[model samples]
Structure formats: C-alpha cells, structure tokens
Target: MSSGSFIMSILDEAPTLAQPRSTPKHEFKGHKSNIWSFVFLHDNVHIVSGSEDGMMCKWDCDTGLLVGEPWESEGGSINALALSPDGKTISCGRYNGSVEMWNTDGEMSEDILTGHTTWVSALSWSPSGAHIASGSNDGIILIQKAGNGEVEPEVGLMKMRQLEGRVMCLAYSHLGDRIASGAYNKTICILDNNTGKLLVGPIEDLGGLMKSVVWSLDDSKLYSASDKFARVFDSTEGTELYRFEHESFIYSVALSPKHNVLACVGEDGVAQLWDTESHEPLGQLFHQEDRKLLRCMSFSRDGQYLAYGGDHENITLWVLRVIAPELLVRAFMIILQVEKPYSRTLHPCLHHSPASRQVLSP
Candidate 1:
C-alpha cells in the first residue's frame, strides 16, 4: 500500500540496507531509553511500548503517531507493558521492581502491583483480564488479581509463583487460560493459571534468554525465540515441533492469526519467516540497520501485519499476506480465519488457544 514512512526521533533513524526491508512504512518514536518491549491492543489500532525512558507510550499503530502525550509512570524505564484483554486497563513494569496498572481508557493508575526485588521485565494478563501476571529480574513471577473496584490488594484477584531466573517473556493462550513464560535461564515454563502450579518446563529449548513467547491462535501449542532460533512445541504434550534457526540472535517471534506461519526477528537485524506446517525456514526480513538489534515483534490482531521494535527505539510495523482457515475440528469451539464467512469452528490450521481449559493435540 503506502510508501515507507518516518518519525523524527530522539536518535536519528539510521540508513538502512539497499535490499527489501527498505524503510519502515511507519515509525513510532518517544521512548528516551532502550525499548525492549511492546504489545498490540484495540483491534490492533493501538500499541503500548515501555522503555528506560521512564515512560510508556500509547500510540496509533497505523501511523506511528502518538495517541496523546506519552503517559508518565515515574517508576523509571518501563521495559515491560501489557494491555488488558478488554482494552480497559494497562500494566507497566519499572526498573526498580514495581508493577503498576493504568486505566487506559481513563488514563490513570488504579492498581499498584509490588513484590519483586528487581526490575519487572515481563508482564501478562489472563484472557479474562481478571488476573494479572508480572515477572522481574528478581526471578519471581507475581500473580495479582485485578483490583475489584478498589478492593484491598490482598483480597484482589492475584497470586505469586517463583521461577528459576529473570523472567523475560510471557504469553497467554488464545483462550486466555494457560500462560507460557520464558526466562533468562533459557527455560520456558508453562503454568496453569487457575491452579497456580508449574505445569511444565523448565521445558528448555531456548538456548539464550527467552525474549518472547506466544501460543497459536487456538492455544493448543506454543513457540518461543531465545536469540538463536524460534522453537515450536506442543503446549499439551510438552514436545518440540520445530526450531526455526536464525541468522543472528533471534529476540522476538510471532505466529500469524492462523498459526501456520512463524516470524522471528533477530538481533542480527534480520527477521525470518517459517512455514509452521513444513517446519522449513523461509527467507528473511531486514530492517533499517546493518546489524542493529530488534528487541520485540508481534502479529497484528487481524493477523495481517507483523511489527518489530528495535534497540534504536523505533518500531517497524509491516502489513503482511493472509491465509484462510485450515482446521479439521474434533470437540468444542475453536474460531479461526475461514476462507468463507460461515461461522462454526473452521478447519484447524494451527491455532494455540490455551484458555479453553483442557487442550488436546492432534
């Protein structure tokens, strides 16, 4: 569609390679510090990014334009941010080990989640958004109940669990039930959010710090990238599927809406695409720099755009190709992008919806 775009930044956008990754069609700028985290929300129109800049910015994903002035969190470089599923609230992690919640619709701090001894590096919310999970450099994952109308933090819906190392990346299943977390210790821990028990992992495959984790759209399985390659696994069986190796350190990986595609962005400054079914490595997607590290990435809610964030602090959002439903169902309801608009659970392409409670792998 549109031509490449630009955003005047704190640091000038560097010259990119002569090849295809060209210029970011859109660029969102504001973070004063390194931005290693970002998440999409609101029909994919908005993006919330946290940075060492001591602020979290909510911006227009389409134009890389600020929705309003960046919100001041004051806790210091906010490297972790998660938007509630309902799009009503926002959760941010600060450098000094504190997690705070903001009413995104209202733009105010309504809940404060505290407990870690180090900076909170990753955070997530249950599908229902009734439960909030935050992990920190302290090597602990704090589970908190979203404050029920200003109720005391104790009575609020929350819980806490311990992990082996600095918790870095977190993802909930499509159904919003199970949470798979990646940590600095190179382990991916799959937990039952309701039971609050370690269901799996220290299920290690991530060779480096697991920077990003995500499940298929239906939440049956998971895929994670640890700076080396993106690995796919059966969330139910705890089995490895495929490791899409990277040319450089892979820092972020995202699954398309149908779960048939995996896009992993590497710090080596290139992003690779893989066929989830064949487990074969496709080509790569490069960005503005020769080897500048890209910190985060996500597929748009509509599953048509692939966005990546970098150490340079600018975000690159790309519109991508689409694939229709590929499901061949067996039990309950599992929604997917069908070729036609007929509405029953379509063919199961490769979805990962974990919140359905019990998941069975084919």
Candidate 2:
C-alpha cells in the first residue's frame, strides 16, 4: 500500500469520539474522609482505595459500584497501598505504623506486620512479588517477606534502612533491582532492593519536599514531583535530566502502565498529561474545580483509564478512551512511527482547538 494509503487506513481504524465533558466519568463514592491512595488491579477494571477514614474499599470501575464489604483498618487512617504483582494480595499501610495484608478474594485475612513507631506512609511491592517494602513517618523503610507475614529478624525481615526525613513515597523499579524513595526532607534516594544499602542517595537539594517518585519502564531514569516542578533524573547517577514546571505544588505523578505517558495533578486542581519521551505536555487536561488539591492518582494497566482523588471523600475515574478519542489516535501514531516527523496540523477530527492538537508531537 502507498504510504498515504497506510496512514489513511490507520486513521480509519480510529474509534468514534464521544462528546467530551469536563466532569469525571465516574465518581467512586464510599470513603467518608480524604482518599489518600489507590491502585488498579491487574484486571484493569477493579480499583482499591485507602482513605483517612481508616477504610479500604474495592470498586468496579466499569459499573461504578462497590465490589464487596469495605475493610476496616486496624490502625486509624490508612495512608498508602500496594498490590502484589500477582494481584491476589494487597498491602495497606496505616497511620498506626502497621502494614496489613489482605487477600483480594474478599476474604479479610489480616496478616498484620508491625515495626515502625509512627505512621506508615508509603508502600511498594517488589515487581517480583516476593517482598513488600513499607516506608514510615518514623523515617524507616522495612523490607519483609510477602508470604506468611514474616518480620522475624532472621527469617522474614530481609532489610531495613533509616532515612533523614519522613518517607513520603516509594516505588520499585520495573526490574525489581532497586527502589526509589522520596522524603519530607526534600531528598530522593535509590537503594539496593536486597541489601537495604543506599545505592544512589540522599540526593539532597531538590527544589522542595519530595511528594512522589516513579521509575521509567526501562529503569534508566526516575521521575519525581515536588513543590512546583516534576523532575526527571538519571536512575544510576542521581543527576537531574529535566523538569516540568507548574504553577502550584505537585501532589502526585503517575506513569501509564502500558504507555510512555506521565500524568500529574497539583494544588491548582488541574491534571496534565505529558509525553514521557519528549517531555512536552500532551494537551489534554482535566480540571477538578471543587477540590483545591488532587492528592493521589493511578492509571489502569491498559493506559485507557485514570483515577484521581484528594481532600474529597470520593475518587474520580476518567475514561481516557471517551474523553480524548483523538488523543488516543495520536498515541497510536506515536507508538507506530516514533522516529518519523509529522506536520503540526492534526487531523480534522482533532481540530477541535489549537490546544487539543498539541499531541501531534514530532
């Protein structure tokens, strides 16, 4: 087929567009207090969230309804959550400095693990699913066995390290060989996942308190959100690569599980998407007018859905497939011909506005 014919055929396969609405597709209502954290299950349809109300609830994103009974936290104020790689287990960190594990089958089997003396603020399950890492307000990060609730000094507890500030966020590298952590002291650290040795930092002098950290899919770079900027860094050298600046303090940063898009929300209550490769805004933005801060967010495994929550009692799920039909088509084009340059003028369907056509990145 001629090159023009091939491009036309690809555009023909683009899905139909729905009238975009500024409102969220689904607002999952259950938590009575601020929603702090959440994660999408491997199925990509169910999402589990933890909140300041000390409850963890699972919701079916497709139906916008609760999946089963909400699990009450033994420790008050569940602060963070992580799901095992197999998706069968979810680990919850609470304000009481304890980590609780539950089976996803709706059976509330409590394998409570305790060590830190204050709030457990962050949790990350190793990509291999063999270990769970919990970070606490006490400035400690503990690695323990995921099975049988082992924290025994000799058998279950694998490694532990103390940081200079309250650990705010933690994320395991895709390769599971390292962990990147952000702390309240305005520092970022990369530690060897097995030995608990600091491999890269206490890399200090970051612009502000580190709010979130995530590794590139290839594990070569790390991304973090702070006061007024989200930065890119070399995962191995601990060097800054670039930054995305915002008008307000950034609360969270999430990379799509299957795409090179990065999504972040801030104190301005506006969520922005960016091209991870080019470090440019993707033109699609979601604004939450009711809330001043969007504290947390997660992307579905398929990269077609997004969930974000904050000071409000509910989480909002955005169906990207419906909200940005042309954006997804541009994403498809990027994946297919990343090396080729294209004219800035977008297809007629994407000509809704000059801002919407920004996804036609070269």
Candidate 3:
C-alpha cells in the first residue's frame, strides 16, 4: 500500500474505507425543544446551543455537561448564537429583534442594544476578537465593539451598504481580513474587513436562496450550498471550481482546518463525507430512522470529531481520523483553456443557396 507512483496507479480506482459498524459515538439529550443554533467553541471542547424553548445553554462538547443553568431569553425564538474566538464571550440573537451578549461571569450587558424588526439570522466575531458582526432578516448588518467595563456594545458601527433583502448567514474568514454573508436576495457578498467595502462580485446560485457559506481553512476558496448541490468557489475570483450534487438541500457544510476533507449534512438525514481535493464523497453517516432531518452540523477545529443534530432534541457526535490516500493522480485536467467564440457557419442548421451553391452564415 505504498509507492511513489501510487497516485497515478489508482487514478481510475475509487476510494474504499472500513465501514463504521456502530451508531453515532455520543447522543446528547436535554433540550425539550428543537435545537436550531449549535456551535463548537474553545477548540471544540465546549458546545453552545439555543432553541425555541426561549433558552440558551452551554454544554461540554466531549461529555455533554450542562455548564450552567439555561436562561430564558427575551427573544422568543432563538435565531442565532456566537462565541468569541477565546470562547469566553457568548452572544445570543433572537427572533423578537433583540440580542444579548454574555460571558461565563453572567450577562455582560443585559437588554443592552436592540431593534432589528425581524430575526437575527447570523453572527460572528472578527478573528482578532475586537469586533462582532450580526446580520438580520431586516437587512441591516451591524458591527459592535465589546464593552470594556460594565457596559454593552459601548461602541459600534453600522454598515451603510444594504444587501437589499434578508440576510441569511455571516462568516468571518480565518485570516480576519474578509467577511462573507449570504442573503435571501440570491447573492453572497465577500467584504473587505479593513475598508468595510464589498470586494467580490456578489456570488449567486441558481436556486435564488443559499443555505450557507463557509471559508476554507486557508481562505483560498469558499464552500456554499443551494438546493441540492454543494459548490466550491475560488475565494479570490468567485469562480466555481467544483460542484457536488446532493440528494436534498444541504443543511450545513464543514471543512477541516487543514483544508483537505469536507463534510456535508443534507436535509434528508444523511451526512456526506468527501475528499475535498478530489471532490468525491467517501463515506456516509446515517442516523436513526425517525431522527434524520438534520438542521445543523459542525466539525471541531482539529478535525478529529464531527457533531450534528436537529429537530430531534439530541446532538450526535462522531469520532474520525483522516486516512492518507494510498493512490496517485494518473489523470488530471486544468480548466484554464479558453472557449472558442461563436461561429455562425458552424451552426447545426444546414444552409445552401441554389444559385451560388455556397452556405450562407446566419
């Protein structure tokens, strides 16, 4: 199973792996309502979730410990949640147009700032953890600076550029230099962090509403989902590099920190694992029959664990290791070739003149 020509030798061969014989490694049970907001923080040691039960709780991602008493939030429906890069500060946004920023010490700022008029759909902190960004269904995006003393978002900046529709998701790149947001207007925006300017042409999908958008570890490309296909796009040029079709709408997508493997969770209760470099699905994860319909999925920072759960009120965590490919690339193609321009004479319709007997160009 080793050779310098290994990749070339197995170009036409498919990938094979030992099948997993057991159920999902861990099944956490606690939430009485649907768990819609889930995220792993502090290097995946802790997981935070918010639900329709009007409460947010933190859990030990490894052991599922209830870190603290769940608090009833003012926002009736928990729309989104975020943990600072340090995992010390957590923020919860609600459907009732209010946001609460909290920490392990308790509520840092209660009823601090509010007014979106709709659900707060997405939230993320800058990589440097200096500022926080939130997007909402009302189409307003805000950037707020954490308070130093006993204050709540004492300093903040509101973006003047509106996406013209509801904001679906927001993400900050690993480098902290760029931020990407998907909107209901059928477009995704990659913005320059320094200037707060839109950089890339709005990335759009055919379905008109993107499910999610995430940046690869190196920030070289972006993985996006729409309808039934997961697509990888060049982060710089906004050009699609690969398109992998799924059986149903992709609920979420996760890329390993090393940027070699990807996991896609679809609406049909199937978790798809793929070799990102080759753009091929390698394995599939199946949940219990009635527990399928996953609404979210996430991978730890180290890529050693994958966790997913949904309306079933349970979180399933799985353990995995990346297996080095024993094959080599025998076939590869570069898509840099330019396409030929239109040639009217090459039309499929036959054209003949009875007088000159020469075909005329349309």
Give me the candidate number with maximum TM-score: 2
Off by over 4 Å in 2: 1-21, 152-162, 322-326, 331-362
Candidate 2: clashing residue pairs, number? 0
The global C-alpha lDDT for each of the candidates, from Candidate 1 onward, is 0.67, 0.79, 0.66
lDDT of 3 by residue, 247-289 (tens): 7878677776744677777678777777787675554555545
Ranking by lDDT: 2, 1, 3
Taking all chains together, each candidate's TM-score versus the true structure is 0.76, 0.86, 0.76
- Model 1 lDDT tens row, 60-177: 8666798878778568777787888887777888888877887664376656777778898888887887777777777776677777423234322223334566788777776766
Q: Candidate 2: RMSD over Cα atoms? A: 4.3
Candidate 1 CA-lDDT value: 0.67
Model 2, residue 162: what's the lDDT?
Answer: 39
Error of 2 at 65 (Å): 1.5
lDDT of 2: 0.79
Clash pairs, candidate 2, are: none
